[model samples]
Target: MLNRNNLKVWLKSVSLVGALWVANSALAESPEEKGLRIATERKAADKGWGDSIATTKMILRNAHGEESVREMRLKALEVNGDGDKGLTIFDRPRDVAGTAFLNHSHINEPDDQWLYLPALKRVKRIASRNKSGPFMGSEFSYEDLASFEVAKYTYKYLRDEVVNGEKCWVLESIPTDRYSGYTKQIVWIDQSHYRPQKVEFYDRKRSLLKTLTMSDYKLYLDKYWRAHTLSMVNHQTGKSTDLLTTETQFRVGLEERDFEQNALRRAR
Candidate 1:
């Protein structure tokens, strides 16, 4: 049997150890931690190491039954703690020449977007509310062009589902901002790479509005994985956007200065 003083000391030590363990476990898991885990995986899928440049062709089909094609060139640089900045130049259709778009993604706060039109000779700031609007008359919304930050939405793990013969985790996400037109989104993420293989968007009415599918994945730089094609179809309007990534280059030298408002006008 232990003396009274020794028993008290032993009890105190056990209590301290238990309290420390609980605190450590709580610190290991936080909302930011969960969000960062998902965001990191998404960022890797989008702009991984050695992925320096990407060129894509966008085909837009409107509800009125008109079709248009546009070519875009994207160069990514300085992908580190400060966040990634990319310069996108629109090439094709003489009417839209010299048009450029710039994206500066911040870890916090809304991303800054600007579009420079040759005719106007001025760069226009893209409003956050207009994110849901079509991009240059395409079926793709402005939000689609912007990088998907985990901070923009709240996520919940739904269940496991089969997509393209791969087991995936179905996650339901709700936009955190009022400016977002989508009421909710369902995403299918592959278990192996954590890449989103498909997504479905619901409108303000909570009705299924659009479905996006990604396929034709190719590995780059032995670490980076990219999807060559992404197709989005609007169920309500019978319109669709087909984006084909024709070329991509990785690990090329780029700087934040290249993605500035002043550079937007001269992107081409």
Candidate 2:
């Protein structure tokens, strides 16, 4: 019903409209937007774990290869609007036995942490400024053991690469918390499973400080993923800590009250 010229013009208009729509959609999402979106999606996917329990053996090594072992039990609860709560109870290493630590993390506020010392029969609230200190002589800081919340960091997608035969997305996360020990952390997350495989920590001076590698992940409830072994190597001190999880159980029916200070005192 139309001449060749008319039909050509009509096709060109439709093609132009499609092109414009694609361009607009692409422009709507910047690199930062895309990075945050990826982080949010990964966070959402990891939600609903309910509760979990794990037994960990932490082996600390000094520069000269001296080693000390500490065994502990960990219990965690997922909160709705706030960051998750966790309690760690020390069992072995007689010097530190009957010691418990509790942490309550918030979205934008400094985390509330307490240490229960059976020797003193008192609960010592950890100062926000001291959260950067190592936890019980381990390489992991108190801040490192807190539950990872997306709001705690601002993310920037770096690139995609293969790590240990797994395809991973490299992401740089700047801590939003001022008291964080590290200037920034670069993470390698597996693309297929959304599990973190490695992280490099940069110190306050923007120098390479430590590297953490997680492996031997096992799936729980057919959805949740947890790494069984976490190894942290301190570059400056030549110290290392390896946390081997001997047992892990999810959906332990843990309640909010179980992570309170009173519960910490009664942990042993």
Best by lDDT: 2
lDDT of the structure predicted as candidate 2: 0.89
Q: Per-prediction count of colliding residue pairs? A: 3, 0
Tell me the lDDT of model 1 at 127: 57
Kindly report which residue pairs in candidate 1 clash with one another: 50-250, 50-251, 52-250
lDDT of 2 by residue, 35-108 (tens): 68778888888999999999999999999999999999999999978988989899989888989989888878
- TM-score per candidate: 0.81, 0.90
Q: Which residue runs of candidate 1 sit more than 4 Å off their true CA positions?
A: 1-51, 63-66, 78-83
Residue range 64-95, candidate 1, lDDT tens digits: 86888988888876555544677788887668
Question: Cα RMSDs of all predictions?
Answer: 4.3, 3.3
